[model samples]
Target: MDIEYIKDNYIFEKLNENHNLDDFECEIEDLAKFLKEDAWNQQNMNLSLTHVVICDGIVVGYVSILTDAMKLRILEDKETKDKICSKLNISENNVIPAIKIGRFAIDKRYAHNGLGKHVFRNVMLSILDISENIVGLRFITVDAYATAFGFYVEKHKFKYLKKDQKDVDSLNKIIKIDPERSFSLYKDIKSILK
Candidate 1:
């Protein structure tokens, strides 16, 4: 279960208790704290899987993913829906299987070094490999932060999950406190594997 990757001179490994998370500081204060304090506990509880990027034996970045399900309607476009259904061999009405990038961040020192793209690509590639054998996984999704929206949408080619008025209204209601903003984005796994 140790998913490892070597890219852009960094080694990626599953974040475990042995990895030093304390010094890993990303731009996002919450993200840095979560990786340092909570990721291990969440991993132990079967909540999500977190992977760290190591450069010269120092933990500089991490990405977390969870095996999850999405409603078929979560897709923004008909073509994406069709592609997913064809891959899973299920109708459009069926709930789609997915993996979600729950959290991702690179240390402040590594920002603008093109490391984020490398780490993101590795995460998607790992999910694509998992879907081939796991039978149901058809899409990779992310609740993207507002600032990183363009990175996910434009750079990574992740499509925004079209939200209806009702959906937006509900999300707005629940997100009142602190008002953290994010947009749901998805990419068809079939396209990635191709």
Candidate 2:
């Protein structure tokens, strides 16, 4: 498939009544099913904004984003956190402001065709737009599955949030699904655009 043609033709929009979600399918069952079943409801409830990728009127992929708060766990030392706060001109707090990519998946038929990265770039750009309007959202965070760790970390250059055992155990209890493999990665919005 021609990249520009696909990029130009595909429709990216918020999930709405006109969109059909039942037929969406991806290699990952959970991700596909979430889009087909729960995405619209979540959007309707104002929990997340699900952006669907459509080509020739068929749903090819989707991504969801939501305002989120994360702890500054990447900064291990208090001094580091303090310095960052000083640099940002914000008081040090338990939670750091963020925009989370809650769900991201492409249809099975479209896998391995570079559409995922295309859609991801759009997601980041949209986050940048949001950050421009809303202050204090400095980071974009993703809790990537083991299968997607390389794409987010290696390809996208998102930093993994390093944690000690206590933090790991706490995260494990909170995540409760492949916690050992789940990666909490983040990138500064400004850094990404740069």
Candidate 3:
């Protein structure tokens, strides 16, 4: 688990038909299952695009991303909404283009090193490139697990999406599976605007 070695050696490659994911495990069952079983199928379905960090023909980490749009009105936390408005210089009643990190996980073996943060930086960098060239995306969103709260919020500056009652459907579905689910969280791209 040499962080510098990984940084110098690992390459981000699009998940493809030839890749064998049998040994990829992040110790989080759901995340591992999603990568090994669902990622390719979902990619074929145009649901999400997955990328793997490979080093010496092994998968060290992976992330799945997809297009997302956030309706500003759903940001019920007044302070959060106001901050977003002031930073992006926009009203709080329109749709803001975004990209969602559908899934993000690092291998269990790479847990304690700086690899997770390194991989996340790659994610943001890739999104920034896309934002500059392909689209004018304004935000980044994630359905963060409770265990990931500190990682997304404190470490990465993500804030909870404080939607009103109208956000019940998605909340309910997540809550049904894990009662401690954190619902949704977002990072304003304006903070890192190019």
Judged by whole-model lDDT over C-alpha atoms, candidate 1 comes out at: 0.77
Q: Using alpha carbons, what is the TM-score of model 1?
A: 0.82
Residue pairs whose backbone atoms clash in candidate 1:
none
- Using lDDT as the measure, the top candidate is 3
Candidate 3: residue pairs that collide? none
* TM-score leaderboard ranking: 3, 1, 2
lDDT at residue 144 of model 2 (Cα atoms): 83
Q: Candidate 3, 134: how far from true, in Å?
A: 0.9
Q: Which residue segments of model 1 deviate by more than 4 Å?
A: 1-7, 83-91, 164-179
Task: For residues 27-143, write the lDDT of model 1, one tens digit per residue.
Answer: 768889889888899999999988888877888788888987778766777887777678768886787778899999988877766778878888888788888776567778888
**Which runs of model 3 end up more than 4 angstroms from their true locations?**
76-80, 83-90, 163-182
User: Per-residue lDDT tens digits of candidate 2, residues 39-150?
Assistant: 8889889999998998888888899988887676465445545766778676655577899998899888777778888878888887888889866687788888766766
> What are the per-model C-alpha RMSD values against the true structure?
5.3, 4.4, 4.5
Worst 10 residues of 1 by lDDT: 1-10
Write one digit per residue (lDDT tens) for candidate 3, span 1-194: 57788878998899998888988887568888999999999999999999998988889999999999998877745776788788878898878899999999998988767788878977888888889899999788998776666687767877776552344445555545664565587877766433
